[model samples]
Target: MRALSPPVGLPMLAESDLVRQVARRLSDAIVQGRLAPGAKVAEAAVARELGISRAPVREAARLLESQGLLRACPRRGFFVRALSAADVDELYDLRLCVERHAAVAASRRLTAEARAALRRQLGLMRELAHRDDPARIVEADYQFHRLICETAGNSRLLRLFDGLASELRLVIGLIGRLYDDPHEIARTHEPVLEAIEAGRPERIVAHVDHHIGVAWREVARLARTLSPTPGGAA
Candidate 1:
């Protein structure tokens, strides 16, 4: 099992604040592959390392479990969630449904500020792709989608998208190696922005569907590679 690193010098904040901070740090570590999937997340170990109490660490693990980033078992505590092909399919399907609606809503009336924000995110994504940091690239990619969700102006829709943030970052982390060319990553997102700029809802939806469809395929491939071999029963 990979070791869970404590956040540097945690402040003596409120219980909820401590839990949230611990959750965020743990989530980032998991997304960055610092915490391997299926590895046990011992609250005692984490709490000890952070110089905090186990209560907050336990609460943080529960929060991560709710985000689909961790799994909790009876008497087994928490472990990083091991994703499967089916999980990938389901996630992408949900994203397709939500994002298609968001794209349409965003395209209905692309305000000047929204357009500028979208363009800025796109440019940042392109720039980040050129860098050697996969995490930054993934974040920039997320920003692009988030910009569209914000433009949609539907609070519920935005919340739905926000809820998927952790899983999406984990997926990108898992498949970062599959993206051999950073420029290609940037290129895949270009059509979505162009469609939005065209102010065509159907076109935007089509572009989003295609983008997510490609990602689904990549995730499926990774899943198959990670699956157990035949006759290798547990």
Candidate 2:
């Protein structure tokens, strides 16, 4: 079994909270590529590394499974879920549809507060871009788009976007860097926000399409090379 990094000491908390912490550690490993795609999650090894019982590790794996980040085989236990280029393309297609409509709706219902929030998020993305952490950068990027969906005030749209979060994060993590410079990734959203501020539905949709479309093309191309782990194992 591969040794996994232990998270910070577990705080005194309820059983559910402990499970959540374990799940977070595992999820971080997946996002950071410490745990490669299709790698089996040795529950006992993880428990030993964290100095905890195996029960919580098992439960956490189940939680990750629900999030589409891990898969549980009949007798092979849990392994990181593997995604292919086609999967990446399809996921982005759904994302584009949801975001295009959400951006259009947000433009119609744009509020001062939401506008400020989006700008702050953009600033955070710019700041994080200069750093070496891809996960934080990707998170900031996701939040900016998420803000648009929230501003749209459509619960279903937001739910759909949230549903795609884990898989999208994994795909971006695999691609490593979407643009030549991380700042370029942040800059792509500038036009999207500008179009929204202009309060033009067609313009907002066009910018959203272009922003997401470019990422889709790049990620799909990269995913073709990485592909999925054969037989769902490394």
Candidate number achieving the greatest TM-score relative to the actual structure: 2
Residue 161, candidate 1: C-alpha displacement in angstroms: 1.7
Candidate 1 lDDT, 131-159, residue by residue in tens: 76777877787878888999999999999
Instruction: Report lDDT (Cα) of residue 17, candidate 1.
Output: 93
Report the lDDT tens digits of candidate 2 across residue range 23-96: 98898788877887778899989999999999999999999989889988888789888776778778998988
lDDT per prediction? 0.82, 0.84
The count of backbone overlaps in candidate 2 is 0
Output the lDDT of residue 78, model 2. 91
Candidate 1, superposed: residue stretches over 4 Å from native: 1-13, 227-234
Top lDDT prediction, candidate number:
2
Position 176, candidate 2: lDDT: 53
TM-score quality measure for candidate 2: 0.88
